[model samples]
Each structure stands twice: as C-alpha cells, then as structure tokens.
Target: MELLNDMALFVEVVKAKGFRGASEATGVPNSTLSRRISALEKAIGLRLLHRTTRKVELTEAGQIYFERCKRIVDEARLAHEQLGEMLAQPSGVLRVSLPVDFAVIYMAPLIAEFAERYPGIGFDFDLTPRHVDLVSEPYDIAIRMGEPESSHLIARPLASLVPRLYAAPRYLERSGEPKEPADLEQHECLNILKANTWTLHKASASIQVSTSSRFTINSVGLIRRLATLGMGIMLVPEAIVMDDLAAGRLLRVLDHWHGKPTPVYALTETRLLPAKTQRFIEFLKERLG
Candidate 1:
C-alpha cells in the first residue's frame, strides 16, 4: 500500500514536470513530494529524473516506469470510482472544459439544474476556447463545438445546432436583402475563423456561397454582437442568436435556405469514465437530444 502511494506520487510529480508544480496540483508540500520521489528512486535502485532549476526530465528508465505506473494508478482510480457509483449519490470534483460563449448562453441553466440534482458533485469549469489535452490535462470532460481532432479521445454527440444567415434590420436596409446564395459574394460577411464559405440547403438542393469579410473574429458571441450592431451579415447557429431575433435586434435571411448544422461533442480521454462524468454526459444527451 505504501509502495503504491509512492508510485502514484511519482507519477503525479512526473506529469506535473516539477515538484513545485506537483505540490500546487496535489496540495502536497514540494519537499514532501521530492522526498517521496527520492524514496521511490532508492527503492527501485535507479535515478528516475534529471532535475535542474528550470524543469525535471524523466530518465530513460523513468519513462518506461511511468508508462507502466500510469496504467496501474488509473486502474486503481477507476476501481474506486466504480465502487463509489454503487452508492445512492455519486461524489467528486467534476472538472470540465467548455467553450465560453456556448456555456454561458446555452448551458448555464442546464448546468445549474444538474448541480441542483447532484449536490454531492462539485464543479470546476474552464471556459476557454483553447483546446485542452485530455490525456495530459486534469479535466474530466470537454464540451467542444465540433468534432475532436485527436483519434485517441472518445467523443459523444450531444446536439447538432442548425446554422442560418442573419443580419440586423439596419444592415439589410443599407446592403439590401440577398435573393440568392450568389448575392452573398457582393455583401460584407462577418466571418468566424476561416469560415468564409457557407453551404445553404433547401429541399434536395444545396448551394455553397463564397464570401469575403473585413472583420474576422474567433468568438461567436462577438460575431453575433457585431451582426446586431449592423456590422455585416453573419452565418451562425440559430440557438446563439435566438435572443437577438426575439428582441427584434436581428432577422433571419434566406428563409428558403439554411446553413449546415454544427455538431457539439462531449470528449473524454477514455470510454471508461467515473460515475460523475458518465452521468453528466448522459444528462447532456438526454437534454439536448
């Protein structure tokens, strides 16, 4: 049991890169983590890490050992979590990475409801647009707007958001309404990232329109705001602009054509997840399906 604890500590220290970082992550003193790693090295009869002032590098032996130890630690953790699931209430810190605008505008109410249902579960949310590494990061789940790039991670579909073209009344008054997809080429489009082209579907037909933009921003909220301010027309998910449309701030264009649906996924490092994480994903699917 003592050896297993030491091995887990060693793994945490290696994952964190340095004793100070490990201390901050695990809430253990740096001196204690250092001593435990030293003890682990002595017991294994090998130098596990090359320590310098700036960073700690794993020795060849340490790299090999970490590969084996990580699996054991993960299995042990999974075992404990599986047992914990048998209880009436699941309990743990549920760390999640979420897209900032989406979470605030769409998921906040659902999250609040989930919290009320599972009071035993605590949350730590990172609402950033940056992609988080599921294997290396401490996050239990990540709610992403599109398909995950990494094949190693497991992803479950939560919802598909139908997108459409929208513009403020003021902008349409100035630029005139687009009668066809080709008309978009003549208008100033507010683009998100590199999505300068939009595919619109009507009945059995689809048209791809190429557009140019003077303003290209990464944030969906900002793009919606810019559209409301009559900066230009925007192609965005209908749910994102629902409030603006209700308040007469923006109007949907091309009633006969709608943009392609954007999928939202809940990503995890492994398919075998804790009860807390599994429940959260299930809850999202239930609500969003």
Candidate 2:
C-alpha cells in the first residue's frame, strides 16, 4: 500500500538520520524521499519528524509510530527473504546474544561451520555473561545457560552443564586432600563471589561449605587461573575445566559427588523461529548431544 510504503520510507529516513542517506539506502531520490514522508505526515495528520539541516529528529508521535512501523517493515523484509530464499539463498543479518564462556568453548566452531554453509547470511553476535531480553532487545536469538525464570519467551534446550570441583594437584599435595566436603572448610577455598555459599554433593548427600578465600574474583577465567596456579580449590563447570582436568593441572574432587547441573537453552521472541535461528539451534543441539 502507498501508506505502508510511506511508513517504511519514514522509518528509513529517521534511522538513516538524513534524507540523502535514506534515499541512497532505499535507492530513491532525496526529493522523492522528502515528499513521501510529507505525504505520510499529511495522511497521519501528525508532525512525525522535525526537519533540521544537520540531522532529523523524531517527535513523540514519530517515536511511537517508528517502533510499530519498523517492526512491520522488518517482518515484510523477512517475508520477502523467506520466499526468495526458497529458490535463491538465505541472506539476512542475524543478531544473536550468547553467554561468554559457552560461546568461547562451544559456539565458535559451530558458528564457523554456519558461516561456511550460509555465506550470504551475516551474523552480529554479542557474547556477554549477562542474560539478554528477547522481547525488548533487537536480538533474534540468545543462547543462555540454565532455565530462564522469565516465562514469556520460548526456549529450546541446547545443552546441559554440571558443576565440577577441581583444584591444582600441587594444591592438594600442599593443603592435604579433603576426603569429604566438610574438610573443604580447613582449606583456602576459592569462591567465585565473596558473598555466596558453595554447595557440593557427595553421593546423595549435599554439603554446603562457607568459603574462606585468599582471593576472590567475579571473572570465571580468573577463577580458573587461580585454581590452576594452586591458590585454592575451585568449583566451576565440567565443560569449562575439562581441559585442566585432562592435563592434570587440576584434578576433580569427589568423583562420585553430584553437583547441580544446569540446562542451556536457545531462546527466541517467537515460536515461529527464523530459518537461520532454527538451523543454529539444531547445530548447537546436535553438538551438545
């Protein structure tokens, strides 16, 4: 529709921040772009944008309308891509968020393979330890660890991670071995955070150890380094410290003990996952299995 086209043009103009830029992006002349936006303002009967020689600025109505129109334009673009890709190739910018450690350990290889398979598709990935919102954020997909407390979004299980206790072999030699969880109290236990208590499980019996730490850090990488340096015993994920355990830099404590395990999920805003998202999720799921 003409109105839809005008709406789309207006959004582009605002986002691109200049009539000339929007015109170039949409392959329309700057004069035509300006006229279309004017027409849109007339039809809507609202001043959408404040014209400035330097930069375009959106009014309050413009901001509200822009959000709605942008989503519609995005969906329209996606619809066209879906149909075109049926015969051609999948091509779009995929915005993704992932947990830092998991991406470094697991997602790197998979993402590499995905790039090889879909050369047309571009990825914008954010790797942070913090959880990201699927609804409000622009991200198309997020790979998260553990069950999300937020019940609004759709999530598919990608993998499982179990807590693992490991310490440098030298630490055990100098500090003496802790045969039971209670004995950990006698040793300088490394805490990921200075405030939180550590929970360890042996057989079916769970032990809670209050930490006495010589060093404390929030970064998991730093914690692992301290553990490898024989500073103290550390508790982390099996997936995270598998190499250390194998290389004998760190050895597992209470091999028969059970630690809390968490499930990783591929989260999205919609149940109707995009093809790129679906494929990436499948790839991670397969790799995890």
Candidate 3:
C-alpha cells in the first residue's frame, strides 16, 4: 500500500538519521524523500521529525511510530526474501554479534565453512564483549556464551561447553596443584569478572569455592594467556584451551571434577526471522549441536 511504502521510507529516514543519508542508502533523490515524508506528516496530522540544516531528530511520537513501522517493514521484507529463498540460496547481509575469544577459538573454522557453503550471504560480524540491544541494533543474530538476560529475544541453544580448571605447568610446580576445590583458596586464581566463585561437580558431590584473584579480567583470551604465563590457575571452557592442553602449556587440575557446562545461544529479536538468519541459525545448530 502507499501508506506502507511511506512507513518504510520513514523507518529508513529514522535509521539513517536524515534525508540525505536515507537518499544515499535507498538511491532516492533527497528532494523526493523529503517531499514524501512531508506528505506523510500531513496525512497523519502530526509532526514526526524535527529537522534542521545539519541533522534530523525524531519527536516522541516519531520514535513510537518508527518502532512499529520498523517491525512491519522488516516482516514485509522478510516475506519477500523468503519467496526468493525457495528458488535459490538465501542471499543477504548476515550481521552477527559474537564474543571475541569464543569466535576466534571455537567458531572461526565453523564460520569459514559456512561462508564457503553460502557464497551469496555476506557477513558483518561484531566481535565485542558488550551486550548489544537486539531491538535497537541491526544485527540479524547474536551468538552468546551464556543465557540471554532479556525474555523478549528468542534464544536457540547451539552448544554446551564443558568448563574445566587448568594451570600452567610452571605455576602448578611453584604453587602446588590443588587436589580438591577447597585447596584453590591457597593458590592464585584467575577469574573472569563477576565470577569470583566456582562450583565444581563430580558425580553426586558438588563443591563451591570462593576464589580470589589478583587480576580480575573480562576477556577469556586474556585469562587464558595469563594462565599460560603462570600468573594463576583458570577455570574456562575446555575448547578454549585445547591447543594449550595439547602443547603442554596448560595442565588440567582436578581432572575428575569439572565446572558447570556453559550454554551457548543464538539470539534474535523476533521468531519470524528472514531466511538468511533462520538458515544461519539452523546451520549453526546442525554443525555445533
């Protein structure tokens, strides 16, 4: 419909932050885009944008309208793309957010294989520690290590990583190896932020140890590196330290007991995803599961 077209244009303008940017993105002349938006305002009998010579800002009503219009436009676009997918391989920009360490250590090979299989799909990957807003951001999916906090986003389980405790051979020689979980209190522990405690499980027995670390970090890569440098013992996913373990850079302690398995998820804003996103999630589940 004409109204739906105008709503899609409005959403683009809001996302681009101005008519000129939207014009560049949509390949429409700035004058025509401006005129259509003005006509839309008149039809709705409400101002949507506050425009100046330099920039355009959304009014309160415009913000609400943009949110609703974005979803509708997205659904329409997805429907159109799904029809195309039935005839050929799904093709589109597949934007994903991933944790840096996990992507490099565990997923890089799998992603490369997937890319090879789907040459039509382009990738825009964001490797950062920050939790991205699935609603506000343009990411198609986010591969996260733990469970997502928001209930609004749809989560698909990809894998469960078994975590284990490890220390550099030199560090174990110097500080002595911990025979049990409680013995960790006497050794230097390297921990991720907000993870000062570790719960190790063995059959029916579980031990909770409050770990102390001189250097608390946010990066799993950094923690692994520090553990290799003999700074302290680390509890991390076994997949992350496979190379180190094989090379004798790190030695596993408490081999009979292991930390809780951390679940990995692919998060999306809505369940009704485009074919590109849906296929990508399915591919990950098939390969990683």
TM-score of every candidate: 0.68, 0.65, 0.68
Residue-level lDDT tens digits of model 3 in 1-289 = 9999999999989989999999999998999999999999999988999999988999998888889889999999999898776745668899999999999887898889989988889999999889898899989999999766868889889889889999999999899999888999888888888678889999999989988988869889999999999999998988899899999999999998888889999999888887788888989989877
Worst 10 residues of 2 by lDDT: 84-93
Alpha-carbon local distance difference test for all models: 0.90, 0.82, 0.90
RMSD, each candidate, Å?
16.6, 15.9, 16.5
lDDT of 1 by residue, 6-78 (tens): 8899899899999998999899998998899999999989999999998899999999999999999999999
Model 1: runs farther than 4 Å from truth? 1-88
Report the C-alpha displacement of residue 147, candidate 1, in angstroms. Answer: 2.5
lDDT of 1: 0.90
Task: Residues 1-289, candidate 2: write the lDDT tens digits.
Answer: 7877887898889989989899889999999998889888898899999999988999999999999999998999899898877745456788999877667765687789888988878999998877787788889998887667768789888777777778999998999888877787888877766845677776677878776887757777778888999988877778778778789899988677646787888888888866777777777888776
**Candidate number that wins on lDDT, 2 or 3:** 3
**TM-score, candidate number 2:** 0.65
Worst 10 residues of 1 by lDDT: 82-91
- Steric clash pairs (candidate 2): none
> Among all windows of ten consecutive residues in candidate 3, which has the lowest summed lDDT?
82-91
